[model samples]
Each structure stands twice: as structure tokens, then as C-alpha cells.
Target: MPKVSKWLRRWSLQLRWMFRYFLQWRLRHISDRQLVIGVSVLLGLGVGLVASFLLFTTRWISSLLAETPFGWLSSLYFIFPIIGILLVRTYVRFWFQGKFQKGMAYVLYGISKRQGNFEGYHRYAHVLTSAVTVGLGGSAGLEAPTVLTGASWGGFFARLFRLDSAYRVILAACGAAAGIAAVFGTPIGGVVFALEVLMANVHANFIVPLLISATASTLISRMLVEHELLTPREGLPAFDYVHLPFLVLLGILCGLIAAYFMWMSKQMTQWELREKKNGNRLFWEELFLLGALILFLPPLYGEGFEWLDAMINHHEMAYLQRSWWGHWLPAEWGIALLMFLVLMLKPLATWLTISSGGNGGAFAPTLFLGGTTGYLMAYVANHVLHFPVELPATMFTLIGMAATMAAYFHAPLTAIFMIAELSGGYHYFVPLMLITAIAYATKVIIQPVSAIQAAAQKIGAYLPADKDKAILNNISIKHVLERDCVPVPYEGSLRDLVDAIARSRRNIFPVVDKDGYLKGIILLDDVRSIIFKPALYDKVAIAELVHAPPAVVDIHESMEEVMEKFDATGAWNLPVVDEGRYRGFLSKSNILSVYRKRLRWQIEHFG
Candidate 1:
């Protein structure tokens, strides 16, 4: 063992030395921009390979625990999920300070506020926990974890090279793009997903680097990933114009389903119930309940991609019907009913595990919901309405998956492109777009925000493009309000008031009583005429010069409300009242300065 350890360390040092020389040589010949793209390509390749490994490992774990030799234990495979959850909860509570982050929302938050600078633990936390969660039968996907891993790696690479904040954000985005591209094996879709869902800003310069990274990652993962998520099946249905109208209906149904899922997720946010009565001691109680649900509905286990494959491929469907669990069912109708029931329960199962703190993502669930919804819709039209060969459920299944993804994500372009690449052509482009647009429109009418956006909002962050709003929302009035304004005592004479104004640079001053309670404001503009009249200046008291402010800003109020106050009052500044006491003054200028700084940073890093 000692000899092996020594040999491994010596070999690692030699490889590092060689890689350093190679990078140095490459940097010397390339421009800074070219070098960045080159680094992005390599990063994409690495991310793709890692994503493929994660996909295969999780798939292998699922089969090893649930199939053949363990078929007798099929009833207990659900227990494996419990063990996985407990392990994850334990690791997070003890080793990771109890912060079991589960998705790419945190990465988006980081990009918005910290220029993509984030903690190191995030890179491995998702990989380990998500692998365990999906591997052991938790109803989630590896996409989110892979995205986080790639993003963290990109951040680390930027840090290693001491790259500027702007470069760091771009690189982090590149890594994320590569991960998605590799995982789904859809380069264009991956690039658009990164830009639309993760990046704070989209620009012309970003396109080339993202393209380079996404293409490289997809190619690399194609070589490493097994017959899993990224591997497109052969003999997928060709597009038939006769199915276009049905595709539209499928898209609308997807939108409605997305809305229902979002609403259900909100209802399942039962942290308030968990925190009732006492402290958050022995937290993870919900995991056990979620475990029981998976036990009853075996189809909820993992990402449900296997079911999706079966829905589109008849051979796979027939094979599923012949499995140990399937043999108990009556016949064709029995297996079909089981499939339908699984589809119906999938959303609820995902809600239970994920909302309860399981480490995973909704990428797979949304796809599953869409595919099943599409397939079921096709089944109804063909079997019930007797539509002959005019429609195939498999064709609608493909469109349905894209529609659901587009609606839930509110990313029609990404969905369309991803579906196109996944199915290996633009054959269904017309219907894909038609369905994606209708679904997105329906989603907008139902819920204005996507699940991803809503999740990030809990941390006071919004989607990447709304950086200014996110910053304003996260910072409180106490942090940015001007606290250095001069104050005049109500009892003070004009002489005293003038002395206070002369010494202070501010144009607005607050009038306070002896008890430090706010009375009114005295603006330099309002007092200018009085100050010039020598007779009134020395004779008048501060109280006579006082003018009531149009409005008062509360420290606890949101920046949006505060800005509205500024607009309604038409005042340059307003007094900040906290608990009915004058704390400071808030001005439009001060808020604008902070906003400009944040906006400038966002543009530099993401634009």
C-alpha cells in the first residue's frame, strides 16, 4: 500500500509538471480571448466526461439494486432510497455544516451577486449526494448535480488563473453549458439553456465561447457516456404534418401541468410545519414519509427516464411488461394502466423527495411529465377517438417532452433546440415550436415565474438577467441609506439651523426633537429664501421653517416600494423611519449609485 501511494504521488507530480508546460506554451501563442475559448473547450470536455460517468454510475446502481438477482427484493428496493437519504442527511449535517443544497439555483445566485465566486464544497456535495439519491431510487435526476459540479470547476479554474471577475462569470457559465450539453448530448440546447437559465446577461461575445464549450462537451460525453440519458435511440418517428394540431393540444396540456406542478410545489413547502412548537431538531422527518411513497410506486424511483424510453420505444415497453413487477399485472391494458398511474404519481413523488431536502434536480421530472403526458394524450386520441395512422403516440411523446420542459423552464428556444438535437434533426421543428410556444404562453398565464426562478427567489435572487433587481432586493435600507445627514433640533433658532446646514454637505436635513424623534424635514431649497432675509433668518426658529416630507421610507420596506415612494413624492430624498424613530435619510441618488455599481459589475462579468 505504501509503495502504491508513493508511486501515485510521483506520477501525479509528473503529470502536473507536463500539463503546466503545455498550458504555458499554448498561452504564449494565443490571444487572451482565444486562450479563454481554448480553456472553455477543455473544461467542456472534462465536464461532459464527468456528467456521463455520473449518469452511468447512477443507472448501474439502480439496476444492481432492483433487477434479476434482487427481483425478490423489489418490494424492498425502496429501503435503499431511505438509506441513501439518511446517509446524505448525516453527511450534510455533520460534515458539511448541515447545508444540503440540491440544485443550480445557488449557482445562479452566485453569478448574480458574487461574479460566480462560490464555495468549494458545492462542487462535490451535489455529485456525492445526488449520485446516492438517484442511485438508491430517490425520484430525481443527475443533471442538476452535474451542472453544479461543472460550474464549480469553472470557478476553480478561474481562481487558479486569477482571472478577472468578468472572465470568471463567463467561464462558470461555459462549464454549466458543457455539463448540460454533455448530459443531454445537445450542444445547441445546452448553449441556449446556459444563456437563458443560468447566465446573468446574454451577448454576442458569449456565443462563440459557449458554442465551443458545448460542442466539445457533447462530443466528449458521446465517447464516454453509456446507453443512458444522452444516448439517442434509433428509429424515432419521422414528423407527419397530420400530427401538428394534436401537438398544439399537447403543448397546452404541458403548460397546464407545469402550472399545477408549480402550485403543488409551493403547497409542499412545509418547513413552517417542521419548525412548529420548537427548534428544528431532528429535521429530516419528511424523508421517511417520502420513502414510503416510493415503496408503493416503484416507477417514481430515479429520473423516470427508463419509463420515458419505454413510452417512445415499443420493444422496451413490451420488455417492461414482462418484468417481475409486470408479470403480476393482467395483460396489455394492465401494464398500460400501470404506466399511466406512474405518470400521474411522478410529480407528487418528485415534490415529496425534493421539497423534503433530497439532493437532486427537476430536469428529469419535467421531461418525464411531458413525455408521459404526450404519450397518454396520444393513447386517448388513437384508442378512444380511433384516429388510425393519422397520429402516433410516440410522435406526440417527443413533442410533449419538449413542451413540458419549455413551459416549466419558460425557455421555448432551449426546449425546441434540445429536442431537435436529442432526436437528431429538425424534422419536428414546426410542431416543436408550435407546442413550445403554446406551452410557454400557458405557463405565463398560470405562473409568471419558473420553478427554478422561484427557488432562487427564496434567497432574494431572481433569474440571471435581473441582476439589478436581485441586488436591490437582497440589500436592506439600513445597509444603503445615507446616515450622515445633518439634523436640526426643533427648538433651534435660524442661526443654529444655518450653522448645521453650513457644516453639512447634504441638501436635505431632518428636524428632530430633544427625544431624537423625527418632526419634519428642512430642505436647503425650502430655506434658501428665509436664510437670505436677514431679519427672518435670525428671528425665525427651526420649527417655522419645517416642511413635512412627502413620504417616509421604512427600513423594513422593500426597495421596490421605496422607489415607488420616490416617484410618487417627486422628492430627491426622504427620511428613513425605523420603529418610529429617525435612523437616517434615503435619497434617490444614493440608491442610484449602488444600483449603477451593481449594474456595472453585472455587465462587466456577464454581458
Candidate 2:
């Protein structure tokens, strides 16, 4: 009876072992390229579908709310200005509670820290509040919410997969790219934008997956929704050789415009800070005042979306052609003057939205504001200056979009690519590049860090100067390698070799001669072959069965270099030796575990 019980137990153990063997075999063959491609495809599909649905949903809600009998609820647009104020206040109030202070800042933090984890509930709250604020007519765009949603999803998935810090950051960037692509229907723009804005560094290793995901998302979004949020300009003439001087002038004007916006945004935040300190006003109360201001400003009251629609359709309004409210005021200077004013105010609107706690993205608003400014400027140059340059207002608008975005976000390449994607060609590359260069240089001269970087610094989170090299070198094989030594004699039988290898936490074992000198390594395959041919198993020594010249690494070498060596040799496990003696072994699982843990720590603490 006891023998029968032992036999049953042995059979169960054998079954478990075989199951594990099959699982490992399956995992061993799964290539990293295949995993990256598969993940990219899935992410792209999800981002595309979600972005398109959201775009349509936002549009439908805005239209329905405007047309309803309660369409006076459209007066709710007045509330957006205040809502924007409230959004900024909420972010500021909660700034010290975590490492990430704002949505964009959080994304950047995740990338720099290599841990993208954010408080899901808190992030959801921010999104809901912002959405309500913007939907009711907050003078903000929807891109911010979209980006936050995508970033949160990426962070969640990275954690779930137990990805390393580098991969986690890359995935988060991919998420942002996917969201942008889906929302704008510009895959190339999204890809470049992610690299420029979210990732501090760009490497070839990350480009493939990022681009693939962005393209997939864009395609998916197109299938779901047919409308383009920001349509391309129509009826624009190609650049002429005579337009070179005018283009340079336009670039200079864009730089100045970008600088003005940056200044206004900074001032608005400073004003809010002062008001909060002196008046002791709560966020909601300040929001009410902001709403009242909007209600009083006749042009701003019900005209926000109207103006946006006009800009989109290339229709210039008489009022916009004549006036400047604060800096360029009075309504008589014509289209050129209005353009300058709008250019100056674009940053103000963006700042207001962020400050008021309005839920929306600066991306779309920046484009809208920049385009309007450019149109006005171009109109002035042609009609007022009589430069004989027929440069379209749309072209100026596009340039303004790129310039303003480049200045504030510090992503010139992204700005250029995004404009090209939106405009549908590289026809304006020279002008766009020139404008981007000017804007970037101007911003750098005035402010060394971008708003996103500023927000990160406020929360005590900043990218290390040599972070990549430090992380790679810091991960040493000595820190993660398995030290449990279970050596097999060269003269040992095949059965003995199999048992010894099985007892260890690996499939490979080092074989030693009688004098403790290292012979070679015997892998599971060699054991299996010997087992299949019973004659060999019975007659051959372990030395005969072992594979010669085992791949080995020193105990003190960096795990990164060890990994590279393993990759080059296609070895899953390598023996760790010190001087002339074999210490133990290292496997991919050990390195992977260390990386996963490091990433988790960064996310939980920094994100």
C-alpha cells in the first residue's frame, strides 16, 4: 500500500515537471520583436477606437447642448473661463501631494522616472472635473483629457506586464502617441510628438514600436469617425522663390508671437497666485468671478466656439479684423493687427484654462490660436505692407501653430511633423523649420525649461543627467545572479545530470572534472538526447554529453553587458565565474525581476 502511494506521488511530480518544461519551452521561443509588434498592434487598436469615439462624443455633446431649448445652457460657455481658473487652482493646491503636478507633467515624470504609475482614482477625478468644465463651454480644448486617459492606460498596462523601467517609459510614450494620432488622425505627427514632448531621449530601439502603435491608432480612429478635428487649409498656393524674404519675416513674427504668449501665460499664473494669497478666495468662488467676467465680455460670451469655427473655415470676421481688447485693442488696425493681438492672447487663454481647473488640452487650443494669429498677420502683410507676397493666411496659421507649440513644449521636431501631417505635405518645410528654429531659440533664451519641466521640478522630480548610463551600469550580474551552487561531476551519469539540473532553479548545469576544474555545461537538451538513446545514457560520461566552452561572465561585470553578451550568443543562462573558478549561474529571469522591481518603485514613489 505504501509503495502504491509513493508511485502515485512520483507520477504527480513528473506531470508538474513536464508541464513546466513545456511552458518554459514556449516562452523561450517568444521573440522580443514579436512581443513588441503584438503589443503595439493591440495598443494601437485600443487608442484609435477610443480616441475616435471620444472625438465624436465630445462633438455630439457640444452640438446637442448648444441646440437644446436649454441652449441658453450654451451661456454655460461663460462658465468655462472660470472653470479654467478652477482647474489651475486644483492642480496647484494638490501639487505637493504627489510627484506629478499636472497631466503632461505626469507623463514626462513617468518617462524620466521609468515608472508611470499614477493614482487611478485621482486621475479619473481630474478628468471628470475637467470634462464637465470644458463641455459646459470652458475655453479649453479636449486634447489634455485624451492625453491623460491614454497615459494612465499605458501606466496600468506596464505595471500589469511587470515591464522594466525603460520599457514602461516607452509604453507610456506610445500611449500618448496613440492618443494624439487617434484624436488628430495624424499618425506621423503623433509619433514624433511623443518622442519630442514625452520622451527626453529618442533612440532607434523605441521608434519602431512607437510609430507602429501611432499608425495603428490613427487607422482605427479613421474607421470609427470620419471627421477631422483640425482640417487642412484649402486653396493655398505653393511657395514661390519671391516669398523667401516674406517667409523669414513671418518666422520672426511667429517667434515674437510665441514669446508674447509665453509671457502672458506666466503672468496669468502669477496673478492667480497673488489673488489667492491676498483675497483668500477658494477655487470655486474664483471660478464664479471668472464666469461673470466671461458673461460680461460680449465678444467672449457666446463667441468662443463661433470664432473657432470661423478660423477652421477660413472666414474672417469684421470684429476680429479691427480690434485688440488688451494689448492690440480698439478694432481699427485690420486683419494684421488682430492677428498680432490673437497671437499675444493665445497663451493667455491656455494659461486661463489650466489655472481655472478647466478640463481640456492646450494642443488644439494652441493650434487654433496660432492659426488665427497667423491668418491675421498674413492678411496684414499682403493688404497693409503690400509686399506682393500672396502668402495665404492659412499658411501663416499653420506656421503659428508649429511655432507656438515648439516654444512652449520644447519639441521642435514634433511641432514641424505635426504641422506637416495636419497641412498634408512638406511643401512648407523651409518656412516651418525656420519658424520652429526661431521659436525654440527664443524660448530657450527666455526660459530654460518648458512648462512641463517646470511642473516636474515643482514636485521634486527631474531627470538625471546621466540616467540611462547609470541605470544600465548599476544593474550588475552580482546583484541578481543565483548563487546556489549545484555542480555535477564530469563522470556522472545522464540520470544524475538530469536530476542535478532539475534540482537547481535552471535548465543548465556546469560540469566539473574530478579536480574541481570546470569542464563544460550540460543543457536540458543534452540530457534529453541522452535519455532518448538509452545506450548513450548508460555508456557515455557527462563530459561526452556536455557542450564545450560554456559562455561565462565575470561576477563584477554589469548585467547590461552580460545581457548583451547573452544576446550575441543566444544563451539563456551563463555561468558566473570569478578569476578561474565557477561561482554560480545567471539567467534572464533574475535580471528581469530586478528591472521590474525597480520600475515599480519609481512609479509608486515618483509617479
Candidate 3:
């Protein structure tokens, strides 16, 4: 064993030396921009391979239930999901150290708060957890786990190369793009998703690496995976201008449904936050509820992509046979009613799956809901409503997917490109754009925050729309605090204050007691008149001159709140107090100076 350990250490050192030599040679030949492009391509290819493996493994496990060695066990398939959830819960409790995180909200938190730094285990944990959960029919999507795996690898690469924070974030985003691109074979969609959902600002220089990474990942996935989410099939319908009015109505309807999804998601989040229900009790309750839901809505099992495909391809009856209601209801009504149930229950199912200790994300569920809503709308309009012009159900299905995605994520471009690539062409681009825009607009009108933003807010991670707030949120109050201000004794006369001023170069002075509690502040301007008159300075009391500040800043206040205080007080500086003790002074100039430096750093790195 000692010999093997020695041999392994020797080989590791040799590999590190070789990598260092290669890096030196590459640095001499490659520009910084070229290096980023090269790394992006490699990162994308790596992410694509991992994503493809996850997809293949998930599909294999999903089909495992049907191929059970004993036929009788198939009747107990629902119990398997409970096992999956328990497995995930066990992993989270032991392996993750009780810090189980899932979904794009966590990714946003990492980007906005952690400087894109993710733990090394994240590269593989999500892949394993999500595969087991979704594969065993936990009713969640695999896309989120895939993206997190990709982003973790991206952060890993950035650390390996010792890249700066800006590059670290960009690489993380590149990984996310590669994961999405690999899943659907849509490089453009992946690129837009990274820009619209992950990144706060866009630059021409940033686009090159993103595009290269997405394309490389797509190529790798195409080589490895046999099927994509949107593989074009025969008899696929195109967009029809005659269905414009129906498309408009579908957009509004999708928007309302998306609002419901967001609301339910928020409610579930609140429920999960209840202190008493967060442990084993909550897990078992959610598990039982999820089991009941999947029993009746069999289509809710796993990611529901198969069901979505069945709907879009006009194979509703064949797929509906799996449902209990399929035999009793008429063909058209069965499809519509089943779709309606899936549409409404999808959000609840997703909540149950995630809240019950399963590992997955909302990406697939949102698409599923959109598809269901679109299919039901077109089916009912044509069969039951008897419209003069037949609505294209397939086209509506595709558009519905995009519209709901746009509203849920607040990303119209990503949605438009996602469906466009899935269709294998730009045939439905016009309708995609039209419907996504209306849906996003309508949803924003009803619910100001996107689903992702709402989740982010719960964790105290602010994702601001404007550039200024984005930078400010990243800058903590401690980073900008000025501790150089000289403190004046609360009981000291003006004589001591004058002498302290001579020792210090500051204009503002804080009146602090012997125990370090702040009493008030004395501005240098207010004491200027008595400084020249020594007799008057000795006679004047510091307590008489000290005045209460317009406002005091807490040490833990957010930068936005600090800025608001400065604005409200019309003061250039404010005293920082924590628990009635004086800490330091916070000046507008210092914050602006730090803000400028950060802005420059962003411009340099991003450009």
C-alpha cells in the first residue's frame, strides 16, 4: 500500500509539471481573448459529454421499471419513487452535509453571491441525485441537475487555471449553456439562455466563448446521444397565418397559467419554510402526496418529456391508454381533460417532487405545462368549439412551450430560440416571437418577479434588472466602510476636540463614550468658529456642539439601503453603528469610488 501511494504521488507531480510546461508554451503563443475561446470550446465539449451520459443513464433507469425481472413487482412501481426520494434524502443528509440545493435559483445565488465558486463535489452530486430521483419517477426534470453539473465543472476549470472572478462567472455560464445546448441540440438556444437567464450584461467579447462552447457541446452530444428533445419527425406542421387570433388567445392563456405556476411555487416555498415541517415528517408527508398524484396522473412520472412528445406528434390516444380515464371518456375529451389535469397539477407535482426530498428542477415541468396547455387549447377549439378555421395543434404545442418558458424565466429570446431549434428550422419563428412576447408581458403585469427571481429573493439573494443595483448588491457594506474617522470623547470640551482634529485629517468626528457607545457626531464645520479662539474653545462643551445625525447606518445594511439613507439625509457621510456601538463612518465618495473600480473591472474582464 505504501509503494502504491508513493507511485501515485510521483505520477501526480509529473502530471502537474507537464501541465505547467504546456501552459507556459500556450501563454507565449495565445492572446488572452484567444485563450478564453479555446477554453470555452474545451469546457463545452466536456459539459456535453457529461450531459449526454446523464441523459442516457436517466432514460435507462426510467425504462428499468417496465423491464422488471418479475412481472408482479410492476404493480409496486410507485413504491420505487419513495425509495428514490429516500435515497436522495440520505445523500443530502450524509454526503452533502445537510446542504441540499437544487434548481436554477441556487445557480443564481452562486453567481450573485459566491463569485461563481462551487464546491468540487457539485460537479458529480447533482448528476447522481437527479438521475436517481427523476429516473425512479419523482416527477421532476433532469435539466437543472445537468446544468449545475456543467457549471460546477466550469468553476473547477476556472480554479485550475487561476482565473479571476469575472472569468469564473463567465465560464460557469458557458457550462450552463453547454448543458442546455447538449440536451436539445440547440446551440443558439443555449447561448441565449446563458445570456438572458444567467448573465447580467452582454458584450461582444463574451459572445464568442459562449457560442464556441455551446456549439462544441452540441457537437459532442450529437456524437454520443441518439435522440434530442426536439428531433424533427414526419408530418410536422408549420405556422399558419389564419391561426393568428387563436395564437393571441393562447398567449394570454399561457400567461395566466404561468402566473399560477409561479404562485404555486412561491406557496410551496413558504410551506417548506415552516420550521416544524422541514424534517422527516415533511418528507414523508410530501412523499405520500406525490405518490397519490403520480398514481392518478401517470403522465406526471419523471420529466414528462415522453408525454409531451406524444402530445405534439398527434399520438394522444396511443399514449392516453396508460391513463385510467382513457377507456371511459371519448377520444377528444379524454385528451383534452387529461391535458387539462396535467396542466393544472404539474406545478403541484413539481412542488411535491422537490419538497419531498427529490432532486430536480422546474425547466422540464414548465415546458410540460406549456405543451399541455397549448394542446388542450387547440384540441378543444377545433373539436368542441367548432371554429371555422382549424387551429394547428402541433404548432400551438410548440408555441405554448416557448410562451410559458418566456413568462416563467422572463427570457423571451431564450424561449424563442429554444423552440426554433427544436423544430429543426425557423418555420415557427414569427408565432414563437409573438406568443412569447405577449405571455411574458402579461405575466410580468400580473406578477412582477419571474419564477427564478422569486426563488432567489427567498434566500436573500437579489437579482437586479438594472446594472447599477447588480454591482451594488455584490459590494457589501463592510467593503466600503471607512474606519479612519477619529472619535471624540462625549464629555470632552472643545479644547480636546481641537487637539484631536490637529492629530487627524478628517472633517467629521463621532462622539463615543468610554465603553465605545456612540452618542452623536460633531461636524468640523460646526466647530470651526471656536477653534481660533482658545479661551472660547476651552469654555465650549463638546456635548453642547454635538448634534444627532440625520440617520445612522447599521453595519449590516444592504448597499441599496445605505444609498437610500444617503439620499434621504442629504449628507455626504454617515456614522456606522452596530448594537449601539460605534464602528466607523460610511461616505458616499468611498462607495462611489469602490463602485467605479468594480465597474472598470467588469468592463475590462467582460470586454
Top candidate when judged by lDDT against the true structure: 3
Q: Write down the TM-score of every candidate.
A: 0.78, 0.65, 0.88
Please give the CA lDDT of all the candidate structures.
0.77, 0.64, 0.83
lDDT of 2 by residue, 159-208 (tens): 65445555666676777889888877788888887766676455566688
Q: Residue by residue across 1-607, what tens digits does model 1's lDDT show?
A: 9999999999999999997886687668755556677678778877877787777777777777755333555557657777777777778889978765657687786676666677888666776778888888888877788887888878877776656666777788888888888878888988998888887467677788889988898888888765344234556677877777778778889999888777877775654455654577433566666666665555677777777777777443554443456667655555567657766677777876665557888888888888878887777666555776557767777788899989998888888898777766477788888888999999999899888888888875566576555556645687787888989999898887888887999888899989888899888888787776767766898988898899988888878678889989898888998776899988788788888887786566446
Best by TM-score: 3
- CA lDDT, candidate 3, residue 369: 85
The candidate with the higher TM-score, 2 or 3, is 3
Q: 583, model 3: CA deviation in Å?
A: 4.6
Return the TM-score for candidate 1, rounded to 2 decimals. 0.78
Model 2 CA deviation exceeding 4 Å by range = 1-26, 31-33, 68-76, 80-101, 122-130, 282-309, 318-341, 385-387, 463-607
RMSD of candidate 2 to true structure, Å: 15.3
Candidate that beats the other on TM-score, 1 or 3, i.e. the better one? 3
